[model samples]
Target: TQLLEQSPQFLSIQEGENLTVYCNSSSVFSSLQWYRQEPGEGPVLLVTVVTGGEVKKLKRLTFQFGDARKDSSLHITAAQPGDTGLYLCAGARDKLVFGAGTILRVKS
Candidate 1:
């Protein structure tokens, strides 16, 4: 089984601030995906990185995959209160293994 280690389990920041979250693993993966989830709702996929060193951007957010395919990072610029939620990274081999996730609270 693949295991993912996510850093800064919880983060609280003021609006318009920037923050970065990370997901790491010792095992390699075929693909990595990032998601955002709000209370009482299922996760919403933000981006999928299938190749090593891949980087994707969505509005104020940027997602990057490590060259080794064992790690990933999410950077959010000018964060807003609406961006507050759970951020998750899932790595896939034959199946998907998810990180414990980071909880972000962007206070206005």
Candidate 2:
């Protein structure tokens, strides 16, 4: 079974807005990764959170890991059209378990 779950299967937002996406799981992961995929391509790794209570920032994007390492969140500041894509969260244990993903569309 998939160990990870992502919320907001679909999201539509305008430029300059802020939004947050969540990823949850019942099982603890050794590490968690966030990825963004565009049309006709594979997912590109955005960030990885290993330690509990870890927070990572990539430009306007902020990622946080729960204290238990079983959940995570991604926050985007000033949404942009370039940020439109499928956002995926993956948890690594014996293998990489990916959530269904959140499809985000940012319109200008």
Highest-scoring model, TM-score: 2
> Model 2: per-residue lDDT, tens digit, 48-71?
999999999999999999999999
Where is model 2 more than 4 Å wrong at Cα? none
Local accuracy of candidate 1 as per-residue lDDT tens digits, 40-85: 9999998999999999999999999999999999999999999999
TM-scores vs. true structure, each candidate? 0.97, 0.97
Q: State the C-alpha lDDT per candidate.
A: 0.95, 0.96
Q: Which ten residues in a row have the lowest lDDT in candidate 1?
A: 1-10
- Cα RMSD for candidates in order: 1.3, 0.8
Candidate 1 local distance difference test against the native: 0.95
